[model samples]
Target: MKARRVLVALAMMAAALPVAATAETLTNDMVVALVQAGLGDDAVIAKIRASAGHYALSTDDLIALKKRGVPGPVIAAMIESGSQGAVSAKAAFSADSPDPLAPHPSGLYLLSGPRMVRIDPTTSNQSKTGGILGYAFTGGIASLSIKAVIPNVTARVRTKHGRPTFYFYFDEATRGLSQAGSPSLWLSGPASAITSPNEFTLIRFDVKKDRRETRVGSMNLAGAKAGVMDRDRIAFDYEQVTPGVFKVMPKADLTAGEYGFLYSVSAGAGPGMWGNGTGSARIFDFAVHP
Candidate 1:
């Protein structure tokens, strides 16, 4: 009897809510109230999905929601709702903004002043697969390493900033602009294949007099694979600007040298084992000038 009365009062209150409040505005407090009013997880989740959920889902926020007796499933639904909302909001903002960081061609870009400078894709001219000597010296115990040698000592695209910011757009439209006339190559299928920035590596090339080199991967005598060595890899941080869009920045300031964003598709061997039934590799090369 009391539960019936509570439900009736809640319905009346909802009816009295302003159009904006009654429409797409579902808040954390309202969710707690609904759960307290004896709503099931499905009911709460349905409400969340139907409304624009303004949920504070930080660690502390989640903990508070759990403490308030919100069901685990409801919490999970809240998270999904929050993620969808964020992506939608980001897409809307990107679509409206005239900023250089807004959605553009699907490729790597460096932000220079008010303009976005596209980084052209290039392939390694030569590959040196060594570590065989090391393996022999170690009695087939050491791993075999492969280094990709790009023909030019210097890259055409140069930036004065030591730690430049880069943007990546993986939209299906304008996919050919970044692939160096090979759109069917890297990430051809689903745009979701390379969702995270971790899929790409920031590599500082070993600048020789005539070429720049970096270790792509290594393989053991037994065909076990060890991906790109840590020595040549530079750490970076990234955040999703919108769906299929990301902003990347190096964790530490890069020293003036040749660098590139390297993405490779491994074909059973190791990364960058291009040609001869191996796989393919793509790099967006640039130089950080002092």
Candidate 2:
């Protein structure tokens, strides 16, 4: 019924879902396959192959993964490993983490035309301002990406007049994420374009966690838009869809450019994870560009 309760229910469902794999139970074939595919390292592959337990993976979309860099060896190992597997088979983050409404500063984003402006493994190093929590820096599994869709961008690009027609447009949500802890299209472009003062809007879904003690209620990601959007950035109050997972989107325009707008998710001891000497927050950044 309530938003928090609904999120908790969804989390329960997630945990109830059958895990696809366990370490030590993977086969050598699975290992080599991932390495060839460029997903994980050799050491990771070997460990996964030697892992234990039944793998929950289905048909194992080897070819499909190749396009996303699942690497034959990595996917195989993931199929063998479980949620704790070293290979970031999938991403896990929630907007309810530290400073749920943390804003992504504005800047300029550059985009290479005809390119999807997708955030790949190469965009991992981008950063704006750092956060005090474990997620302070721009590093995390980018599961989603949203940009402000500014109008008249095409006209400015073609005209010699340096018009401010660049609009920050994301796919209504974090469109760059690949479901895995990697670069998404939204966070892989020019950092300056997305974080600029008047470029993109940073929306953070603010989900209430301390609703009178008994952590209850939940919300849905569907139809959920950014909390606030301006010519520059959009901010969303934290919305809890479930633990280890979060989602948000844009409500305004996003200009075109090549930049990396990343999300910081801290499930462990990375940057921005530490809080007021209490609970820790997972920080992750999904990069994207126009």
Candidate 3:
């Protein structure tokens, strides 16, 4: 009987070993730090470490990580490459670097800076395009309006089994047609499948353009429509662009003027806003310029 009891105890201990071996011994402080650090899930850590590599991180690095839900400072500290750091920092400082689109933080922002003048580039949760998106610009003296149909661009998504839950990406680039001389939305919200939204939103930025101190302009647009179902957004902006286009210098060439900018847009809610649509805003010809 005693021998039989010993054998049973041994079997129970063996059964418990697997659970103990597989368990991850993480401390509370460690878990908290990881979360506060924006470690998110285990997969997030791997992706951050992988793409970040040995590169040193900066504000742009943090912005890139923001798209990934990682902590900004942590990402900034992790960048190991100078080129990557510069690239990411540029994104961080430029308002044009992002626009609203699909599942995640999809909100359109139209901005113009020295050398980097990108047009409507859509930011979305994923790739699901069915209709139009909007763009607004803030300039020194001009209020511009823009509209066009969103084209479905390929998006990067994470899957559980085979189902894609989240997507992140930029839209296809749009070409500039003849410039409209007045403040207007060149196109209504998205109208074409393979094209970019029109450039209709604008704000005159010349009020404070010449000041050595940084200047800002704001734009507000509202009551527009998003191409997807139930997608709604209200976009506001403040901008200041140097006068010497394409010149990245400490002293900005403002054409010597006192300028102020205002641009804004409000679109009804759509599927693109909350994963209700088939695709998301990738990016567009969203622009800010001279």
Candidate 4:
């Protein structure tokens, strides 16, 4: 009778083996596959939170993870699991309330740092240089300054969870013309030139081993659509908080990896104006860790 009972208990334990084995063993590649399959951020995050495995992530792997659309929080979690030190939660950007020409605070920013950058006339022109003749006329040439606060910075910053907001400034004089329907309108007057206009978009960037970035995809924030540009990118929405202050936090969560707050300076209405026809865009690069 005792032997019969023992055999029954063993059978019961054996019956549950397949169920226990069904649980997924999480991995970076598996996460990417989940994202490609249209898993929601919350669901994917939950899987990551439940995972107790290790990852072999390198710089290329990190970049690839981002390109596959994993949110930063998830990546940070992965990094935390694979490495020793705690992943930093502090992130910030420069908000120069006073002088504008100083370095716009590039490089990796901690999530706990200031999340803003001030874009003004002086700082916007920080990189504007012309030939000797153009430099000779300081005031006239300077008017063509094309600097954006986070001027095309090529570095990554770690951000905290929830939504990410980007803040910047734009003068009233340059408003309402960044995306004019007809160039004739802004071109009508001498003072009527296109400016930054607080316009921005969220874009995915692919980072090579050398850290060289290539544009892989663009997100239509308003339309809520993601498209393939070159087998490399993801998409998200953004909102304009005010005239100059803009935010790029999408309703969906971001997977880990590198991204950009791509903003543009409007091409003024004339051939001699300070834009690159389609407008010259500047990249504010950042990374979202697990």
Candidate 5:
């Protein structure tokens, strides 16, 4: 009897809502209200999929929703709805526009004024393992470090901006026409499949008279490992612009120097790997000029 009365009340409350042809935007409050009124997770998720989502899904907002008895699946659905809305909003970029946010080929591109310039990949041929002398001198107490060296003193691509913004397009669908009739090719082989900028490391190169070098890994008594040293690595922030696309920018202003986005194929492989090499790695290199 009590359960029947609750269902009747819920139906009456739902019927009282405005009956417009357009689906109303779903908000956090409405979601909480629906959950309080005894809607199942599937029903709530289906509603979210049908309506435009304007949910406040911040950490606090999510906590509040959970406290209000919203299920985990419903919260997940809200997050997905918000993500789709954000992607749809960015999808408005004109197909032919030269904007960096516009559709681009599957590669890394630096934003140059109104143009999106591709950052070509440079293969590192020389791998210099160092710190071994320190280890030997200390009776294996010190760690050994490995560095990848590029033969060129300067990169072919140069940017005047110390903190240039870069865009990464991972979608093969966008490769058509934008590539100037070139055959479909992965710009960085295995690195091309990455979906997040976290997979890449931004490193400042130590400029030499004829070559630029950066540490790729360090080896201790334990074993060999792969990664850039903290001093050589530049931190950056990234955001998803649209599906399969991301915008990356340095967290702080970069100093004038040679830099590259290094993506290693496997742990401890370092950046010396090219497709033809023993291991695989890719470096999208550029020089930052003052």
Candidate 6:
């Protein structure tokens, strides 16, 4: 009788165990298989929701899903499900609470810096195209000026995982171009001097559908002392934390997407504000992982 009781107890325990304990974790291939097996988005999402395991997704995984005719919303559901093992997206970034990824002023340097290190031609083989301008005064009566500039270039960098604040460190070289004089001086100074903290704006870069990009929001400088800022333009709040160190605080948590900073020549009044460049902007691209 005692032996029979022990056997029954063991059998009950086994029955209570979840079947998924022996099942494989979720994967892109598994999702594809399910879709091919005629499962709908609702069904797929339900399975993922009921499943228990971390989903390790890669760039290839996303591309594969798109290629396999998976709807973007469905793919987004998969990513959200994977990103938050159990927590919801809203819970992940609560509006009332301080962002867990918020950087400490002292610790900002550890995670923030210039993504594009201006390369010296002597140090690297990176091809560069740009030159200086010249002005000639003939007979001290009339003057001839020559202008030359390269097309805007982009730099790609990955965002520090989970960090919401962006830090920009200006070495002596960057400050001379962007910082130094007051905002009023920007118009009269060299084009290089057009780079101000307010000149920075966040943008979204879509890799799919012809690699198009768009501005994230319409931001403007509110508390600036001097500058030609438009309320209609997208801008960021900038502060000089130290001599050459600056931090840009976004209005809200950045959603999972590909984003970048645009350095606009029309950062002040508007297009052709500087009367130099054609209001073209330099972009520094980055990705926010889910």
User: TM-score per candidate, in order?
Assistant: 0.55, 0.18, 0.15, 0.31, 0.58, 0.31
Off by over 4 Å in 4: 1-156, 173-199, 216-240, 264-281
The alpha-carbon lDDT assigned to residue 84 of candidate 4 equals 33
**lDDT of candidate 5?**
0.75
Tell me the TM-score of model 2. Answer: 0.18
State the number of backbone clashes in model 3: 101
Candidate 1: list runs displaced more than 4 Å. 1-98, 101-103, 172-192, 220-223, 267-279
lDDT of 2: 0.32
Off by over 4 Å in 5: 1-97, 172-180, 183-189, 265-280
How many clashes does each candidate structure show, in the order listed? 0, 129, 101, 25, 0, 3
lDDT, candidate 2, 44-73, per-residue tens: 666665665344344544555556455565
Candidates, ranked, lDDT: 5, 1, 4, 6, 2, 3
Candidate 2 local Cα displacement, residue 123, angstroms:
6.1
Model 4, residue 23: displacement in angstroms? 71
**Which tens-of-lDDT digit does each residue in 203-280 have in candidate 4?**
554444544343321222122111223234344454454443333455567776666655433343445333332233
Q: On residues 69-129, what C-alpha lDDT tens digit does candidate 1 reach at each position?
A: 9989999999998877655544443322336445464567787766777787787656766
- C-alpha lDDT of all candidate models, in order: 0.73, 0.32, 0.30, 0.45, 0.75, 0.45
Candidate 4 worst ten-residue window by lDDT: 85-94
| Runs off by more than 4 Å, candidate 6 | 1-155, 160-163, 171-191, 215-235, 265-279
Q: Write the per-residue lDDT of candidate 6 for residues 109-217, one digit (tens) a residue.
A: 2233423221111111111111222112233223222111222232243455544455554332232122212132223423345434565556554443424334222
Error at 3, model 6, angstroms = 81
lDDT of 3 by residue, 124-215 (tens): 33222211232322322332222322223221211111110111111221121112121222233542221211122221121222211111
